[model samples]
Target chain A: MDLSSINWLLLIAALMVGATPILLAAIGELVVERSGVLNLGVEGMMITGAICGFAVAVKTGSPALGFLGGALGGAVLSLVFGLLTQVFLSNQVATGLALTLFGLGLSALMGQSYVGIRPPATPKLDLGPLSDIPVLGPILFRHDPMIYISILIVALVWAVLFRTRAGLILRATGESAEAAHALGYRVIRIRLLAIACGGALAGLGGAYLSLVRVPQWTEGMTAGAGWIALALVVFASWRPWRVLIGAYLFGGLTVLQLNLQAAGMKMPVEYLSMSPYIITILVLVLISSGRGRISTSAPAALGRTFHAST
Target chain B: MLIRHLLAGAAMALTATGALAQDDGEPLKVGFVYVGPIGDGGWTYEHEQARLALVEEYGDRIETVYQESVPEGADAERVLTQMALSGTDLIFTTSFGYMDPTINVAQKFPDVNFEHATGYKRADNVATYSSRFYEGRAVIGHIAGKMTETNKIGYIASFPIPEVIRGINAAYIAASEANPDVEFNIVWAYTWFDPAKEADAAQALIEQGADVILQHTDSTAPLAAAEQAGGVVGFGQASDMAEYKPSPRVSSIIDNWAPYYIERVGAALDGTWESKDTWGGIDTGMVEIGEMTDAIPEDVRQEAQDLADSISSGEYHPFTGPLNYADGTEWLAEGETADDETLLGMDFYVEGIDAEIPN
Candidate 1:
């Protein structure tokens, strides 16, 4: 296949669009992981945010506040996870699963009238003359602001993780809650805040999905992007920049297949559709096999419950 | 054997559950398995609407129970079996994905009547039902043909499944008829009920200058995306998205399940239930026209309504004769309605489309 046949610009643009859903989700997951917690309910939280963002936007007709509402909605819901795992000291996995189940049921119940009704639209940012350039124009400059924000969040997360003392403390907590606790760090509070942050980011991702990306709320609307985001945190090996690359890689796969189909390539269309998901699973399995001392980058207590008595 | 015994045990447990729910004697029980949430405003929503209608019509005579957003897989089979085990005399598995599970479960409960939606499979105990969604597609495709300035139309497709594909082809046919120059851009979200993805797909389609957007998915997101595009417009799928007034939503095609649902359940309770393949369309009130919005011009709306009425009145058959396959070979002759067998087993794209069907 000639590379020329591929709309690299459109491919890249689609990749960016695809990444916004994952970027928003993975960043939230990263924070939750950084705090020595794993919230498998990213999809649930995102869908909840999707419905909330969708409902609020349709009700209020403001996309900006709609995103904020999504973030808040996600954060608030994630707090239930925080409270369950942190305060009540429940099994994190079980709690996360329940969080997803509860989120699905609650969102469905809430999304009844919101179904089929389009929420208020967010305007695409146009750089005018700059958007007219070949290749580069559509690729880089012409997406909704949330696209740029996702990339910014990645960089900001990187800066926080590698450059800041607070980042070190959070990392330490993820590595060993007991050690971090010994250092006078409030492990529970740190994890709680991290989860809340992750929740809000996930909510933003979901909001971006409903308000900007898809811009409508339907039941179970996140469509496994949240799961992809969870997988991305692992794919990125907990590194923020890697999340960017990983997110875009999978996102590109998603975009490329569709573009190929749209360009009218004579390939088994089902294979094209399944390619992204299959490739991700293979890449993930490959990565997990070679990475043994994953805790180097991984916080020690990721997915493990912390007990003060211990 | 394990499943049979389990189903038998489930029947016993269902008796207990039913006994618990009723605490009194009842002759009949009904349940619904929804693939999407009742609130999704598409297929599941339509099914739920029918369930509500059944409730309204039958009142307390028929005890209906429903579980929403059930996934289509082993879980689906389990849920269907449970509904039957729960002593539901009639069960409606409302999704194309539920076909196999419906059949699988129906085989176990020979006495129980099962109606599987949008599938070809059937058993003595099971029946198949679907709408001529393609017929609806033709009218909207015609409208999109008339309305689009870019000569480009976007279709938000749910899956590559035949049911959805047929609608895409039908829309293409009607669109091409209205304006021979119109080309379609399809965005397959590969989901049955993810509104966020559906909306994103719609947005991308609109960004590509598709002035008219259509959807095979069951959310209002496409119409919403069309609205958000500042000037782009679209049609409603499965439900009347009349909420988006003034612009974006021009008209809608509603899939009505109430009349059929009322009939089937009534039959079941009266001991007249039998399994058969049913493909209902405009004539049966199974597919109804939505409120014609002001967005459509007077003449155009009149023309669409006329075509709809003709179809309902049996004056037209959407898959009329003189058609060609994607390979440019003739499939049907002019003025000959494609036999039910051909339309039911449709696997090829019709003439005048650039899309290639993948095996």
Candidate 2:
């Protein structure tokens, strides 16, 4: 209720911690979707990553290596999806769904011995001097390294998608595979690589949850963050900067609701908890409610399977 | 120290390995069928703890076996059958979801003794056992009522099952008893093993000024939430959550499966097995109270101990009479006590509770 007492700085810091998971997952999805492949299995990849990260971190006693293992574990599983969708020419949605169900079952089995045991504690970034500042100290100077890396990824993705010639080719392939193929681009190969990157990023997101945030390997740890990430990809209209905007918005909703409750607001906590999902749905509806043919910069061959015609 | 006891037990396990060839008169094989991973911080952890206690207590007398993360449907029956056929003299089906399968497995292997957790369907060879977890909730409700500065409490319920619903009512009753102005706000994650959602739910509760958070779902997320938000208090369900001590977790309702494990299977081992439905709480030793940490004020601490003593001494029944439905209609007669049968199949929420129970 008192503006003078409201710590906007801590609030921003909370926003970053909360947004990191989705950022990792969504950025990966952006690459995957930008390559003309739709991965409905992001949820599965994330869970598998969570378990693999936890197991590796617990075994190795290094959170950094655990994150690396998580990315590889996710990318490796996504390779299966890449093969089936790109080479095997299987239906993307069905295979992706199966990936989720299988991941759920597998993680449950693998995490059996790990209950109640705490993993090695993650170290927070100690911005020694800057963190000691009065107003700006905690916000910019304090965070897990994962938060910094995720934001860095947004910048890298933006540069790659908009500036690089390779980014142009990838975007061209997503827009029209036949055209890109005619120009001698390895369309399937490019798409597979993009999908793998997305998986690895999403894997990192899942790992951040187990290794740092909640810091426990829980079954169904991702909950619906993957779905929210999926909605975010569209909300951003598949642009990198927009992904950051969308991610932080959802993250803000998450943090703000908690802050509201902390400030003693009488809103039904249930409804406030459900706000992020509700707002995402509304955003999607607004995005989809436009004029004739929903005119926009959508990838030309999005969600369509391609086969090499003899 | 508990940690040393665990380590010493691990050491004893190595020595017990040599007696593998002795074959002490048709070896007593023990099989554990888990509903979730052994690593989860809630229900399965407690069950696994009991399994370890068995290993510590019996040493080489018991041969323990386990199949982790088996679901509670046809898979449970399959696992139970495999264990029974493999000479498992006793099988512990440790989930209420496994009740039907437990009963089914009991009928198939009449010689095997099955002890199920938190359910009441029993056969001649099958027996049921559970803690009056709701009773512990009442004691915390008293603490929560006095401890809460905002008069709002958050309850993260796993499922709308009778066991979890009963906990909600008990917590509400205690909270209201402590402060007539108290209110309960709930969020159903509808899952037994999700930390992210649990954290999100706890955050929502903490944001809304719920200084006390209670959970029926298994995990340390609520305690983690309490750590993030100062002044928030919580309890460890099914196990003593030692991870968060001193401040957030003041007391806990620890599951004591050792006695029941000894009682039910000891008879079956001695050839006196029979079917029975059992529910034991504070009055019995099935549920033991964890030590009160320093977070609790002295007055609240003494009051909590007194309530725990009354329950353990059989001088108190949490769900006593002069109770009313949510609509203010009388459910329990004045001065009337609810017997085990009525309490076992509890269906209505007494007055002062706000959440709806799914049919």
Candidate 3:
């Protein structure tokens, strides 16, 4: 195997790009789960965002606006889940699944005209002197704005979930809707807002794919990245920082395996193909399992519909 | 006597329609199960194009219905069963993964005829049809080998099926023949259609110094990736991605399934349909090479054209003698050609390919 040919620095840089979408989506799902609501429609929201962002970007020739459009699209779709589960008292799991199906179909229809169209390029953050650094610049500085935004979102999520009163109320509502409601916190409204935020972040992740990664519009282009993001949130034990680590590891392994294969690595391709999923789950489970059973870390009210009256 | 003959014909038509559970006046209902969205602009798009051609050719005589992005396992069987239950006279399951599902569904609906693409399994009512895409691959491989400045050619492969393996080997054989220094870097994405994954594979290849990109997967994502990474050239796969012409997409391998689809549908309509295996190539107009633009040097283009012409005319086979398996076992002696059975079930890499096939 020609291991020398594989550019290690470039591979590291690529892994970040690979991880950004899932990182963005998983961080959002962490927030939603933390707020005591489980929305399984991240895939749906992401695809909706992918198309909405792609169409807007193509029409307006601005990648930034396209991302905003994607966020709006995702939020709108999530609100559908919110309206059904929060107000209409529907099962969160079923609503989330239906949202995914609806999102996939809706995106396909909306993207009928957008197929094969290239989106305006999302330019890299040019940190002039910092970008020229030997080992760090290419890996950390040369990426587009979305990568930073994803990491920033994760950090912000960590801060809010731990430091802010709003985050505490959201967590309390998630832990016990009745207790939070009795304590004068609006459980349904808080859950709805959390779901919307989750969806907007998921949408932004999807936009990162269509606008920056693949940089083209195609039906179902988000593929299973949304599902991976969903899995990341759970494996992270509803923690934001852990979600980032899991996403990078998962995304990094994915890019690394492909790079290894391209480098003519003699490993079994099946093992290499599944390395991302296997390694990510192992590492995260190991990291999170230290505290005890993963279920203990889960929000007690996650997936439990909040009824203020009942 | 004339009136009697006409009456008998009408009675026979009536019986035929009754047996098929349809009226004689109704158009033939044809169902298509695609593994990807039709707008993928590659494999599924080509199949969708053929479906449209079926509509255009038969007009009122044929009615086409299709379900896109159908998963290739139990979901395919359910979709096929639903189509058969809905009185679809003929069904086309257009993906290699649909082989077993097509066979499974075909058994339950014996009255319905099934056509599977890029598959080997067949039943009494099931037919297998696929183009010899390797022939086109050989031609493009020659072009890529000649054009590459780095001598690194990246291949974005789908699954490790015989069809995909055959393409890689054919391309490698021709490419190595053209440039002994050329090295193939293959990455199996394990999917038929995921634009994001395919794009990543392409980017990975480009980053590793591959100047020419080749893909067995169905999507324009690789070409898009190649275009984004300037100086890297690639060929359009399954469909002529003409939009990227004059640059990254130097040429393409076009699958011409319309003629075969039209002929098969006509046979089904006339009650002469029979299960068979069809592996047509450039000579039969099943695979057409897209126009090689000015990006390719004149000498290289002429050489590629000659290679394609020779393959099309059956004067040369892509897998010729003096070849060995990756394990160094003799596969063919000097002046020998591969048999159809061997090509259909190819599982090993030819000599000089440094990578192992993922089982």
Which candidate has the top score in DockQ?
A: 3
Interface RMSD of 2: 5.0
Query: How many residue pairs clash per model?
Result: 11, 8, 1
Q: Which residue runs does candidate 2 get wrong by more than 4 Å?
A: A1-20, A38-41, A48-159, A162-164, A175-182, A187-189, A227-310, B1-24, B59-61, B85-87, B354-359
lDDT of 2 by residue, A1-310 (tens): 3233235676777777788888889999999899888998888888888888989999999999999988988899899999999998899989988887777777777777765556787788887898898777788787878888898999999899889999999999899999899989999999999989998998898888888777676677777777788888887878888889889888877766655544445455567657767866766676567744423656878888987772
Cα RMSD over interface residues, candidate 3? 1.2
Taking chain B only, the TM-score of every model is 0.89, 0.90, 0.90
lDDT of 3 by residue, A31-130 (tens): 8998888899999999999999999999999999999999999999999999999999999999999999999999999999887777888888888999
TM-score of every prediction relative to native: 0.87, 0.77, 0.92
Ranking by TM-score: 3, 1, 2
> Which docking category, incorrect, acceptable, medium or high, applies to candidate 2?
acceptable
Clashing pairs in 2: A28-A198, A114-B39, A115-B39, A115-B40, A261-B207, A261-B208, A262-B207, B124-B275
Off by over 4 Å in 1: A1-17, A55-62, A116-120, A123-145, A269-287, A290-296, B1-28, B107-110, B269-271
Give DockQ for candidates 1 onward, in order: 0.37, 0.24, 0.66
Q: Give the residue spans of candidate 3 off by over 4 A.
A: A272-295, B1-26, B104-111, B269-271
Cα miss at B346, model 1 (Å)?
0.6
B85-110: candidate 2 lDDT, tens digit per residue:
98898888898789998888888888
